[model samples]
Target chain A: MEEVLRRQIEKIVTLTDEEFRFVLTHFTARTVKKHQYVVQAGDPAPNDHFVVKGLLKSFYTDDLGKTHILQFAMEDWWISDPQAYHNKVNATLHIDCLEDTQLFFISIDNREKLCVELQKMEYFFMKKTTAGYIALQRRILSLMSQKAEERFNQFIQLYPTLLQRVPKALIASYLGISRETLSRMSAH
Target chain B: MEEVLRRQIEKIVTLTDEEFRFVLTHFTARTVKKHQYVVQAGDPAPNDHFVVKGLLKSFYTDDLGKTHILQFAMEDWWISDPQAYHNKVNATLHIDCLEDTQLFFISIDNREKLCVELQKMEYFFMKKTTAGYIALQRRILSLMSQKAEERFNQFIQLYPTLLQRVPKALIASYLGISRETLSRMSAH
Candidate 1:
């Protein structure tokens, strides 16, 4: 688990063993069963989770009770409600495990303290957030212009592992396509 | 123009007069006439711009020749082909002036150097990127679930200034609605 996190951080910035140990002090670990809710709508979502193992999703349930998948976090990925964690507001999204999960998490306060204490971590986080911003821009463009077939194909191309690990219905929601349409597209 | 950027930075991090001057050294200022393209699709978009005056837009033109507005930057806002500017790739979107515009910009290299030399700038950028990520998530939710009228109303409520400054056709494009539909809604 330590190696999982250390490797993730090392991809962006090299850290001395002492520095890595210092960084670990700011995070706490947890294990959750399948179908567990990490964050619920209208409640405080205080930490950002980095998955060591298992799959989780963050979704919005609309007034009509229909759900839309905003994102997914698999092994080595991070998940959080941005408004809740960063702005200290209640969550507008629910995050839940699709499988039994083990994860590490850090609160906004700890993250800020860590960034201030380690300039390298600040740089690491800046890069990660910038990359996240770019990805969301791509998603917005795809949602605006792509057909259902194109969206599903792009999803498969970009995340073949996610395609298998994630349910077809959830994948359809993430792609913003009807389950029937997704089924039709996948049939080919 | 220097004061514009100074004030923007100060919103996130404090800087003394001398420190602000040091920060200004990394940016270049430019003035562009209306209809000029700052970033064209398929070209290198090397800088992230901070608008001091006038209006600009980042848009994607589809293969079928339909254009969709991704975002707009008026006074005090930033605009870029996010992927190209952050990832050092060619632009996938076109960014152009909607009016005569003046702005300050920093290249990715200069941004990195500035961040390293001044930790405050790194914090400023990290906060900005995180906020950008959150805003994009809201947009995704709006697109996925909202009807055209709700999307338009939300835009109007969130950016009253933008509604008046932007052309109806472009605003329609940004909202992912047809011009005629927007017209009927606006009429009411």
Candidate 2:
């Protein structure tokens, strides 16, 4: 599990074993069963979780009780109520394990302290955050401009493995499309 | 204009006079007239612009010729095609001035070099990018779940100055509301 995190960091900036050990000290690990909530709406969000194994999702539940999928995290992906974590506010979204999950989590203060201690870690985080920013922008564009079919195709192309992992209804919710529309598109 | 840029950076990380001057050396200043594009689809996005004065918008045009406004940037804000600028791809969005605009722009290479030379700048950028990621997430939730009236009200509350500065049609497009719906909401 630690090796998975080491490799993810190494992809951006190489770290010495000593440096990696230092980085490891700032994080704590947890295991969660399927359907366990890691974050719940209206609760303070202090940590950002980096998936060591298994699947999880973060979603927003509207006042009408409609669940809108915000994101899915698999191996090596990070998940958090970013606004809540960064701003020290209550979460507006909830994150739950879709499969039995293992995660390494770091609080915002510890993450900042690590960045200040290690310039390489700061660089790694900046690159990761920038990439995340780009991905979110693309999702926004897809939601605003793409039709249902186009969005489904784009999603499939972008995450071929997710189709098998995530339920079709959840994917439809993520795409802001009806499950029937996703079924028709997937059939094609 | 330089002071505005300095103030924005200082909000995240403090910089000495000499360091700020060194930072300014990496950027090139430009003035653009209203309706002039800083970026256009199909062109390589090499620079991210920091608005020193005036307003601009970034939008995508779908295949059917429908335009969707992605964001509006005013003084003290940064705007770019994040995917294109970060990934070094051709622009998919067009950013044009809504008023006579002055900007200081930095290319990816120069920005990376600055980060390497000054860890403070890297930290500053990481904070900015994270805030951007949070704002984009909020926008996604609004698009997925909010009614047009709610979205418009959120927009007005978040950016009161923009309602007066940007044209009504663009604001409607940004809110994903019809112009008539916006009119009705505004009248109320």
Candidate 3:
């Protein structure tokens, strides 16, 4: 179990066993049932969760009672409402478990402490955040230029687990396309 | 001049004068004229600019030859085609100056070296990137759920500088709305 987590951390940045162990001590293992709310809109977002298995999605419900997906996390992916978690503000998004999930959860305080205590951890998180920012920026560009079908296809290619677990309507909404449009595109 | 830049960096993370000077040295200052292209689609994104004054917009032209705005940057904001800048990929977005602008430009190589040479700079960038990610996620959520009018209002509230400088048609495209609708909404 520890080795698996170590490998995951290694993928981001190199860390000696001692540093990894030190960082791991602060996180607690969490099990979430399918449909369980890892987070809720309007509540303060907790620290990041490192997924070991299953799936989770960060989303929000609109004034019109529509759900819009912000991000989907599967095994080995991390999920959190970054603003709420980092700034200790009320979350503007909800994170829900799409499957029975196992995650390693760290608090904001603990994560900061880890960063201070382990330079490698700080470097890892910094790289991860940079990569995440790049991905989000590109996605915005794609949304601006690509058709709904193109976006849907890219979504499936990039995150197949989300496509499988999430309903088509929700996916359409996430893609900023109407359900009818998504359906029509899928039929083709 | 340095004081303003120092304050901007301080808002994100604390940096000693020595560290600040060290990181600042890696940046090369340049002036941009109004309506000039900083970078264009299909070209390599080189310099990530720290805007000292004036305005710029990052956008993409779709297959239909319609330009869609992605982001607008004004004084004190950092602007770049993140993917192309970070990964050294050919850019698919174009960045153009809306006004005569002063910027401190840093290449990715220099950025990496700065991070290594100055720990405080790394922390500052990490925090800034995290904040940027959170903002982008919120924007994506808004795009998914909100109507064009609501988005336009939010956009104006959040980025008044952009609303003031960028054309209404580009803002309409940014909100994925028709130019006529933007005019109607803004007139109200």
Candidate 4:
């Protein structure tokens, strides 16, 4: 599990064994069973989780009580109520395990301290955040494109792993399409 | 324009006089007339622009020839085809000036160089990117919320200045709604 994290960081910045050990000290590991909620709407969600194993999703439930999937993470990916965790606000989203999950979670304070201690981590995070921003931009483009078929195709191309792992209904929710539409699109 | 950038960066990381001067060296300032484009779909877009004055909008044009506004920036905001700028790819969106614009633009090479030479620049970019990611997440939630009225309310609260400066059709485009629907909603 630790090596999973090490490899993810190494993709951006190399770390010495001692430095890797130092980074590990800032994170705590835990396991969550399938169907467990990790972060809930209207609650304090103070940490970001890195998936070492299994699947998880974060979603928003709007005033009309309809749920919208924001994002999903599997091994080597990060998940959190980003606004809540970074801005120190109560969450407006809920995160739950889609499968039995093993993960490492880090608080924003510890992440900041680690960055100050290790500038390389800061660069890694900057690179990661920029990449994440680009991805969200892409998603916005797809949503605004208003072609459900184009969106489904783009999703599969970007996250082929997700297509195999996440349920069709959840994928529809994330794509902002109805399940019937997704079912028809998948058939094609 | 230089001071506009200085204040923007200083909001996150304070810099000395010499340091700020070094930062300015990497950027090139320019003035663009209204309706001019800084980036166009299918072209290579190499820089990110910080708006020192005026307004701009970045939008995606679909295959069916409809345009959807992805974002708008006024004075003190930044605009770019982020994926093209960061990933060195051809653009998939067009960014054009909504008003005669004065701006400072920086290439990715200079940006990376600035980060390497002055580590503070890296932190500044990271903080900006993370905040950007959070804002995009919020937008995604709004888009997926499936309530046009809620989306309009959220947009006004977040970018009240835009309502006065931008055309209603563009605002409707940004919110992924029809112009007639926006006119009706705004009347309330």
Candidate that scores best on lDDT: 1
TM-score of each: 0.99, 0.97, 0.94, 0.97
Query: Per-residue lDDT tens digits of candidate 4, residues B29-132?
Result: 99999999999999999999999999999998888898889999999899999999999999999999999999999999999999989988888988888889
Candidate 1 Cα misplacement greater than 4 A, ranges = none
lDDT of 3 by residue, B22-95 (tens): 76789888889999999988999878988889888888888889788888888899899988898899988899
lDDT of 2 at A44: 98
lDDT tens readout by residue for model 1, B5-84: 99999999999999999999999999999999999999999999999999999999999999999999999899999999
Candidate 3 deviation (Cα RMSD): 1.8
lDDT of each: 0.95, 0.94, 0.84, 0.93
Clashes of each: 0, 0, 0, 0
Q: After superposition, how far is residue B145 of candidate 2 from its true place, in Å?
A: 0.4
lDDT of 2 by residue, B1-188 (tens): 78989999999889889999999999999999999999999999899999999999999999999999999999999999988898999999999999999999999989999988988888888889999999999999999999999999999899999999999999999988899999988997
Ranking by lDDT: 1, 2, 4, 3
Cα deviation of B124 in candidate 2 (Å)? Answer: 0.8
List interface RMSDs for the candidates, in order: 0.6, 0.8, 1.2, 0.8
CA shift at A73, candidate 2, in angstroms? 0.4
Top of the candidates by DockQ: 1
Candidate 1 per-residue C-alpha lDDT over A1-188 given as tens digits, one digit per residue, 9 for 90 to 100: 98999999999999999999999999999998999999999999999999999999999999999999999999989999999999999999999999999999999999999999998999888888888898899999999999999999999999999988998999999999999999998888
Candidate 4 runs further than 4 Å off: none
Residue B141 displacement (Å), model 2: 0.1
Ten-residue region with minimum lDDT total, candidate 1 chain B: B123-132
TM-score, prediction 3? 0.94
